[model samples]
Target chain A: MRNQNTNILKATIKDIIVAFICIAIIFFTIYIVWGSEISLAISLVNKISIDTSKKVLEEVKLNSVTNKLESYPEYGTKYGTIKIDAINADLPLYYGDTLAILRNGVGQFSGGYFPGEGGTVVCMAHNSTKYLRELAKVTPGNKIIITTNYGEFTYEVFDTTIVPQTEMEALKIQNEEEMLVLYTCYPFNSIGHTTSRYITYSKLVDSKYF
Target chain B: MVKNIVSYIITMFLILFIIMIIVLNVFSNTILKKEYTIANLKTGNYYERINQNIVDGFKDYTVQSGLSDEVLEKIYSQDKLEQDINSMIESLYTGSKINIDTESIKENLLNNIEIELEKENKEIAQSEEEALTNYMEAIVEVYKNNVLYSEKVVEEIGTVLNKANNIINKAQIVIYLIPLVLVIILIVINHKQLKFLQYIGIGLLATGLFSITPKIISELKMDINNIMAINQATSNLIQTIAQDILNRFTVIGIIMIVIGIILIIIHNVKACRILEETKRSRH
Candidate 1:
């Protein structure tokens, strides 16, 4: 009876091992063949990537890139310096004229023609007493010199006039000759919005291209 | 009698648990063991994700800068933008990131400006070009690392993923085989009641179907509005993936069904043979 029990026990253990092996082989084959696909499926179900509706990402800190500008100035960027001897005005000149740009310093209107283009070069600034306020007191032949990356151009104040704010035609580019226009708000020291513009027109008397 | 009853209950629980382990192994094999991550990124959808990220970044920039939408769009066409980013990603893999010199991507993007400008017929002068280039460079700087996973993430993902796979595989194998071995020992101890193994067969069938419970629950509770709100391609891909998961479960379930039926047949045959022997001996 003892021998018979031992034999039955041994057979049972063999069968159990065989069953476990069979189960393992079946599952192993599946993992070997289809593991990645199933995992991807699970992941896809869990992921949140994109949708039709718009939602912004979390605010990330942006490290400002140190801009390495070429030697030549670009439009809307500060590229030169200006000096008005009569007003003692020395200011950094930017190419594009916008409200924000003017707040910083004098800015040239980009829509108008460029220097050496034989057209009107319009430059404007805020009417601060220190900057362009003294333009009103300037007489003809006052030296207005612009130093740029490209070259330096000196202009002589030949004329000055107050034009209406709506008179954009007064600042129109003339194709016949190169002229520089410096203008600011009227009253020389206005606190609020103004309709009249203080204009100082000058002819380009001398130019030196670097 | 009570001991026998307790033994049978334990045996049934053990069988159900083992069956569930088998189903989970299939899951572990796919999601954990396979390198589905890099492959999915390599798919066309990776580009789509990138395009979306770029659009998002630009949208954020415009909101902050007060730049006109028209001007920003005119600066760089979306297609060219995505292509440029794709090129950057491609470069990072100079056949393994061993020589992943990311500094070159900045130069590469700057160098390829001629083709982009030409495509749009934008006649920007030298000054304008300089300004635009600076703007583009600034944009690239701010978003280059933000738009995707970081360098550390990229470098370590392969090893980290495989390590997880190994651990889960070992755990699953342990859970699966331990109960199976116990049930085998129980069958030997309760030889007279081996016919009760039919209960285990039934449990296996039930567990097989239970494997797809996540899919069923998700579908039942799925909001139609949410689906409509998602992009069509993404939504479609999601459905495809869900279906694929369901199909895998169904395959395992069907296999269990076969195994369950076989177990039931074997138990019935053994019970009938014992019944015949008892009747003949009494006669």
Candidate 2:
């Protein structure tokens, strides 16, 4: 009877062990599968956010031109016509920059402007099929003639400065005579947003072209 | 002596099994749940911080453009929108408490922008062309900066959320597997407990079935609204699922105890029958 009871007890223990093994296998398999699903869900959420942001940006761009057209008349007189020979050229002009119309239809102006007031008018045109690259070769004393419908404005570059991006306040509008500042990203052929803006300050030498 | 030894071993096995169950349940329900919840809460807090950063950054941008209450309100609204998204995501991951749609938020934000732009455009049209152009330029500046800031915040939130999910998954696997392995060892050491084996199997099956039942029901009842209401609702659903799993374990525990009692009764009856047969043979 003692031996029989021992045998029964041992058998029961084995049965419990086997049951645990089965449970373990099932539980682990479920856990891994569920865990993977959760990970996939997270990835999905990220993708959705990125995709939505892109869509919104695209929509904003599409509406910008129309919005600008509706509000164009109040800002300034049609002082002069600015032209860029490059196809699909979209040149945005901030008021405080200068426009320099060069020979051969090439133009370069001060790229940086003051935030609030009209200080310098930077005008840019295509050089080698790019908007700002050709200005890289421009040196001091280069003549930038601006022919406004009212009058012709000519400026000669008197100073040049290589400034960091953060010193953008240096490009602020000055209170004295209208100063023309021309700039572009330095070291032509470099990729990415221009690290440094090449600045040239010029004064109105002549308004004969107008 | 042999009978005493066997009885001791059997008692030890039973005690171990009970202990293992208790440990697993406690870890799963309290420790693991708390870890995941804390992780989720931290993620939400980080999201809020990032949103605040974006708002602060935008306020600076607006200050540069010329400060306006309208711009401040717009920033506030955008911040609120971020909060809404964070809350929704939290709900989806942690519990089924609230439902919110990402699409609706997107639509609302877009409509708000459109309305503001239209109103500004109309005003500019009525005014001088120069003023309108200047106003448009300012709007363009604000919109561009806002978009850039929003994108960064979204990306950061995604990164944090991914980390949290990974942590939760790993915890689930580890916690669930440990008790299961322990139970297997218990069974292997007590080979005479065949009835216990059957009981444990039934217990696990019942637990799994109950745990997953609500999820299955939810899936069956899923609607388009759930997809759109993906943020807070998703977190809430996950929390609800966790609770369901905890409840299932409780049920499993009770069932195992009852089965153990029945097994003990059966074992006693079998012993009595064997003794009677022996007595008759001796006579």
Candidate 3:
């Protein structure tokens, strides 16, 4: 004889279909309300907060007086903008000299002094026309301007030297001058690689001295 | 009814996304893991690639390996020494098997010195062989100490790779099958109207193709040298391994897409038979 109670899974196909549709509706509602929408809302909130914090930091930089900036800037981090009116060369300056860093803008050597520190400040950039290609023509008595969050400094080129890259002694400070020594690979417009460096030596002309 | 339709469409999209996520998770856990990478290095053609890299960078290797300039002077010219090393490494693999042939290195060194001596048209001093032997011994000793000192590392990698490979192979089944079972359950629950199966089948097919995205992206040319800024040999090894992993993923994606299409066809044919049976019963 048949059992008095029916098995739970025993149902008409129609009944099961209705249950399936109901489950789908529940799942859809749950995801739309709590899953994707919630994540989107959270990301939007984070974006706004991050933007405001960045702006405040930028303001702090603009108003910084003769205080010292970080002695070491992290790699690929944009700390200042550099412009040389002589070559009309304008670009962002990063602290590290990885090939990638040089591609986007000038790369400052971490071992040197900042703009107003009164020691030799050394920097480098790619030898491309877009970068320091005009560096080939930067003669003595031309101006190189550096603008950072703290202050601005201008360097008037006094000497140009083409030396073997191994001879970086020219970059060293010989006296108490806030010097800006910038260099790039020599034969700046060469088809292939060159083993020399074209260097520009300039003493700090003026600054909101730090 | 419209709400139901909206619910149905949203659920379909959710199911599609879930399937994609689960498959990608499986890939991340298995293929992209360090264990898998280490295993791939050990078990694949990476060793040969490494050998080629070593040859291409022989001078740098000599300096980095701390071989003194005096010792380098004794070993013929730099280019000649480089050739000898390249030849030794070129004979490293026999078909698919790798025998580093490190044992034959001393013999190879003697042969090279003889070739170099002949090139200079030099008369052999009876003491020349002994002097050459001394230099050979120094070079071989340094090579073994510096380069082949990673036996412990290799052993550890072998153990880990074997364990991970086994787990990944088994988990591969679970990756696709769990989603398949979920789809089947839903299909059976809504058996009266199997139209949703058509959409789910297509979703599975799309998810399968998505599984091979790493391979697809790698084929695109982009200058990303800085992010991978490292020694050339190491970077080359990473690029090769990434390519290998993506190729494996492409095959997996193709397999999943085939299974999906088959499932959809079977469901549609079954639905047709059911519809015909209902009509027959009504008559």
Candidate 4:
């Protein structure tokens, strides 16, 4: 009886091994024949599968020595606030200058620099009563303060201009000096869209790092 | 012994063939079939959820335009959204040009904008007419894009799907024919000893395990439920489809494994009984 049981057990083990060998052969043959195609298919699927596990926002830090930021805020997310005492306007500031962002508060042009980066920082907001409608009242010498998670900086308005919306030169990004360019749709009270931008240029006057 | 080895080899080939059939059929039945996917979308409430997404998306634009949400009201009916989405999916499956009519949306928006302007006692100046046209066009564009996801992407997928269907149709003949030939050969070789059942059982067992392996690995490696799409509604639909596929694969695998195990057990019992009888006769 014991011998019979051992024989049966051995036979079953052999059957299992054979099954595994069959699987191995199938995989090996596929690898030999269609390996590249399979790999390409996998890579394509991976490309479209968005991995939302990655952080949507990261901690932003200003590098004082490099005159740059260690990390930047995610676009479309509010990272700071812009305040102009002259207009009594205090609004959230996002990194990307999209109309969607402007709907809520102010949006910084992603191409520009962060405060304390010693470069141009451009921001825009909708010309609504709640947003930058009072922006026209702001003149040169008025103060605009930007408060971020890392630091605080004050900018003194040096000039204001109305330029055609097509004039990209008015919002030029540079690194020579820390400047702030704030803009809104011109003719703030217009019922619909306007063709020009009201630009307020300011120079950095004070800074406080946290 | 040599004959036995050849039978096992044929059986291995048979198992590999069945696995291919399972994979191909799974794809053909679910993702490849336009009706199947459309059914999934309907059961998943994709239309209503996507409608809400479009509405929410428009809120941001309306706020920037200084228009009240009233302008968006009744601009896009749920029926219109459903019709457009279904048309887009049909185009994807049929490899056809997708043309979503934004005319209705554009007209509705213009009328609403005019109503809002009337309320404020303002007229669109001749100079501002271009801006108004652009604004209306932009809103219509947003509506179309939100409904279709991305036109270029959908068109490319439609093209690829057409090519794949052509290839699959041609391959189906060979995919089915070779397996039948292998099974016939296996039976002819093992018929005298009645050993064909054992080989077939072993083939099935291997195929079942092979089918289940990918599902197990995917579940361990990634969280399929949290798979993101362009928006929450689309994301939910994608997750549902993925889960359905995984569940189907698992069920098919289990069924194969169960049947395979039963056949193998029956063969083993018969072999054991024959051996015992032969021993008694020798004694």
Candidate 5:
């Protein structure tokens, strides 16, 4: 009887051990495959966006701003002609991209209004690529020269600020002074839209194309 | 008595050995790998977001400060008007106290607008030089605020990732040790079941090895990928090798478990048949 009981006990122990091993192997395999797959997918997405931006920048012509009204394209239209050179690199500037000038919510670009009009003109751009990242490195007195079809408008970087998204009034066009406002999302490599906006202010120094 | 004591000691050793195998397999496969991967991803994301927010905040501040004059002028003027109206109301109350005429309050407000307009024009004339300075100062303030915020975000992310990693490490140790403890307890209670317990221990060890092998392979693969992305060529190579070893171990563990289960079942059937035969012979 004792021998039989011992056999039963051995068999039971063997079964339990076998079951545990099976479960562990299955889980381990799954963890490895899933982790690698997710990492690869994320990297691929980031690379694609970077490549696209680089391609677009390469094809665009870099011109100087010469004319004012004649050269000013329609509002909200994206033209690839103007490039802003600041911080030793040239960034493609688009018109009607919404330029908010003030750290406060007031100055913004209106369709017919010129740069000298007393209001802030807000310009928006994507920061995922290198062009916008270059902009993030701008320091005081760094020259931002906007090259338009009509003329080349040069502005000296005077200030930089970070403000909240609720402050849209800071982008409103005000009759204060002609100011060039540049803005992009705060932080270059963030996953989602953040609470604040990055901004730089520059005064119109010269416009040769106009 | 001596035989019983010897058998019990053997039984305890066998049980303890089986438990250790089971625990080691669980610890290596599931807990450690899952925790590390999650911690790394979360920490990376947090830092990325912090950098982004700082940039975005600066953009908004510049835009708003440039445009503040236009928006504030309208709002400021309205506020000034409201203030004047309140003063007039206060004066009216005083007039009733002193017997001064209420019509004079209306006349006083009309004069205030002209004064306010002139003041606004003068301020506007002086604002060009002041605007740039003020705008620059405001931006500097915003930039400072953003820097502080980013630091806080980064610190918080670091803390969470560290805590998670620690917990997972502890869990791995506990899981790996539990089976060994159980085996020891079983051995102390039974004497004659030593060989049977050893078989069971072997099966459990096989089961644990099979279960953990695949997980270990996957984790090693992930570690390799991470190292490769970071340009750590040596680590990547080592991890790749580790991953291969884990894969083979997993397969072997699975086969062992299957064999163990078959043996256990066959043994039980044979034992049952013997019992039946004995009963028939007695009858």
Candidate 6:
């Protein structure tokens, strides 16, 4: 009886081992036949799986040698606040000019430069009451202060005008001088679509880098 | 021992055959079936989410366009939304040209804008004509992009889906026939000692483990909940489909394992009974 029981136990163990071996052999065969294709499929799926676990946005950095930024804030993220005492306006500033970014506060044109980069810093905001409703009221000599994570910049309004919304030349992005070009949809209180942009041009009057 | 080895080899083949069947059936029921994907999208509220996205997107444009919220109202009705979405999905399965019609939307938007302009007693000056056209085009683009998320890739995906569907349909008959032949061979080889039941059970057990392995590895290596896409709606759709497939795999694997264990237990009992009879006859 003891011998029979031992034999039965051994047979059961052998059956399980054989089962596992069979599985390994099947997988091995598949790997040999279609390993590259399987790898390609996995890699394709992995492309869409982003690692949001780590921080990707960093503080804006100015390179004194090139008069350009060594680092820039991630697009769509708030990097600073724009305050205009003349209009009682203070709003978050984002790096991108997407409509979504503009809805939140003010969006800086990605094609333009940062505050300390000695070039045009183009920004735009919605004309709603919560935002730049009093932007048109801002006149020459009014100060627009941009407080960024890296520095504080003050620009004095020198000119204001309404331009056709399609006028790209109105936004002069050059390295000759540090300028701030801010704009919003014109006819601020209108109940319908407006095809004009109310723009305010300012020259950098002060800068304090930290 | 040689006979025993042959039986083991036969059982191995049975396991492979069973795996193929499970895979084919899973694909046929889930990935290959257009209805399954459509059902998943409906259950996930994909259409409603897309509608909300469209509304929010329009609202964003309104901020910079100096347009009131009224211009966007009723641009596309919910019924139209459903129709377009369903039609797009049909195209995906049929490998048809994917075109989300935005002409009606553009016309409706133009009509709405005209009405707004008339109410405000404002006319588009010659200088502003280009801006107005650009604005209209931009709004239409937002609608088109939102309605058909990733349009170019979608066309490629449609082609792939159609090809896969065709291949699965053509290969299905052979997929079903192979396992039947393998099971018959397994029975013929192991029937003398009534060991076919044990071998079949072993095959089932192996198949169950193999079927469930992907879910196990995915759980360990991936954060399925954090699976993302170009936008939130697409992300939610992907996660929903992935979770559903994984759940199905787990359920099928558990069911096979239970059945396999029961068969093995029954075979052991029968073998014990036959052994006892032989012992009694010898005495």
Q: Which candidate leads the pack in DockQ?
A: 4
Best by TM-score: 4
Misplaced by over 4 Å in model 1 are: A1-210, B12-16, B38-102, B114-134, B138-166, B169-173, B193-196, B223-242, B276-283
- Candidates' lDDT values, in order? 0.58, 0.45, 0.57, 0.82, 0.47, 0.81
Q: Which ranges in model 5 have alpha carbons more than 4 Å from their true place?
A: A1-210, B1-198, B205-229, B232-242
lDDT of 3 at B217: 47
Interface RMSDs of the predictions, in order, are 14.6, 14.8, 16.4, 2.8, 13.6, 3.6
Model 3, stretches more than 4 Å misplaced? A1-67, A70-73, A173-175, B1-283
Model 4, runs deviating above 4 Å: A53-58, B170-174, B220-232
Candidate 2 DockQ vs. native: 0.02
lDDT per residue, candidate 5, A1-210, as tens digits? 676677666766755654454455444665686968766754553343222223322222323243123334443443423345544445554444433222322222453244433345566554434335456788778776655444466778788887876787655455466567777665553322245677887777765633
Query: DockQ ranking from best to worst?
Result: 4, 6, 5, 3, 1, 2
**Candidates 4 and 6: which is better by TM-score?**
4
All candidates in order of lDDT, best leading = 4, 6, 1, 3, 5, 2
Residue A198 of model 3 has an lDDT of 89
> What would the per-residue lDDT of candidate 6 be over residues A1-210, giving only the tens digit for each residue?
675566555655555566667778888998899988877766666676766767667667877678777887887899999999988888999889877788789999998889988999999988888888789889999999999878899999999999988999999989889999999888776544577789999999999887
Give the per-residue lDDT of model 3 (tens digit) for A40-91: 6545434432222233332213223543454445456788888988888889
Residue B276 lDDT in candidate 3 = 62
DockQ of 4: 0.38
Better of 1 and 6 by DockQ: 6
| Worst ten in a row by lDDT for model 2 chain A | A56-65
Number of colliding residue pairs in model 4: 0
**C-alpha lDDT of residue B198 in model 1:** 53
Q: Of the pair 5 and 6, which is ahead by lDDT?
A: 6
Question: Of the candidates shown, which would achieve the greatest lDDT relative to the real structure?
Answer: 4
Candidate 6 clashing pairs, residues 3+ apart or interchain: none
